[model samples]
Target: MDSSNWAEHLKQDFSKIRLRMLEKLEEFSILRLNPKHFYSIKVEQESSLSPLAELASINLESARMLHIKPYVVSQKSLHEIEKAIKKAKPNVTINSKDNELICSIPEPTAEIREEKIKSSKQVVEEARIALRTKRQDLLKKFKNWYPSENELHSNKNSLEKEISRYLSEIESEWTNKEKEFRQLK
Candidate 1:
């Protein structure tokens, strides 16, 4: 089952055999192959004879047709063959953005939020109170360092600065979004 000698041994018209193989092959996996899919692959006998190969060979009137090659898949080389099969198959998406996790991850829902409650309601309520007390303590500490008017103006200025910073980030994000949208079309 030497693959190298197959071209000489294959006496049938390549075009006619290919046409019949495409039309008569019942298996989705085999029928999906086009001549483009056969490129660079060498045909060899599959363990002397398999029923599918025998049928394919008979339909094509060539024993050499039974000598179809496997893609020589190994753990290391399987990805390449899988990629080629995916390309040959219809409606297959390999690492496509439309179905990717990054694009399709659902927004966290109320059910997910409720699952985070592991403690008693009283304990959670106390914890919330404690956190509020700590925040108030920090605010009081800041107040001691500045007059109330100065602190109020300082907070407003800080908020304006933060808003400007966020606006810049959003502008850059929108620009990238537009470019991505255009490329998709």
Candidate 2:
């Protein structure tokens, strides 16, 4: 109702937007395979899902190689881990030897690279839609909170500016990821 309360409300809304943006970025990150990406993979367990990292120890053997050894050594557990990796469909060759699984991440082909870029663009667009929805919700809240037309107009301008800044930041993040994906070998 007051100026201070409105400012605080705006701050909370901005923080929520930033948090959602970060979550979207994290989701995008998992779509690509890096040394750390393996950790994001989840395996089905009875009635729950568990992260691959929790079930297995993934060691980076080289820049393009990973050695995964499950802590609970069993035929079924190993098979489940292997199945999870295959389901992820990462550009990697999986070989089971002894009790460990060796993952060989090869350089992306031209077609593969193109596909990844396209997928990244789709993800960026989805993030933009989410951000736009959040902006609209904020505008609705502003309308309900601010009764004066002049004050509402001023707040709308500032909110639009903030939204533009966040959208640019999201674009920059996607660009950096695209560059990284392109440079992979």
Candidate 3:
């Protein structure tokens, strides 16, 4: 393959890596009490489970509070919702008040923040591993092309630079996310 084609392939691969990294970072963010967290809950399918979002209307009563009111009020469904929330373990306080569930998200303590940081680090490490795997795959592809020694060496240098650049990008994202997590009350 020509240098141009190789470069294009690398760009595409790098783009995919970045996209996947972004998705992982989003998951890390969802570890907190955001509306997106509601979407993460999947109800059981014995015809007895339904997603919380679908069963009720969730509203942000305040910056640290959420109010969920089910459209069809039933004790069983409410209990199921409560059970689901507890099972998800979002570290929030759940209260059933006036036929609605009030979820209070507490400020993150030092220990909680530390846990989040550790989780974020794990996610970043996974991305780094993925990047390394992609780099190895690219190297193998280049080797199969039977390029000249000089060309191979030059491509290797370029590939290493790309890998370093991506690694740094992932690190930067983790650093920023860590800061945000720390700043969370």
Name the best candidate (by lDDT). Answer: 3
lDDT to native, each model:
0.33, 0.75, 0.75
State the lDDT of candidate 2 residue by residue for 140-177, as single tens digits.
88778789999899988987887788788878887887
lDDT of 3 at 134: 80
The residue pairs in collision within model 2 are none
Stretches of model 3 off by over 4 angstroms after superposition: 1-31, 40-47, 60-64, 73-77, 97-99
Error of 3 at 121 (Å): 1.4
| TM-score of candidate 2 versus the correct structure, residues matched by position | 0.66
Candidate 3 lDDT by residue in tens digits, 54-170: 878888766567788888887777787887887885577899988888987777678866886787678778888988998888789878664788878888899899889878987
lDDT of 1 by residue, 43-108 (tens): 223333222222222112121121222234343233343344344443322232221111011222
Listed in order, each prediction's TM-score against the native is 0.26, 0.66, 0.73
Candidate 1 accuracy as lDDT? 0.33
Ranking by lDDT: 3, 2, 1
RMSD of each: 26.8, 4.4, 3.6
The per-residue C-alpha lDDT of model 3 at residue 86 equals 79
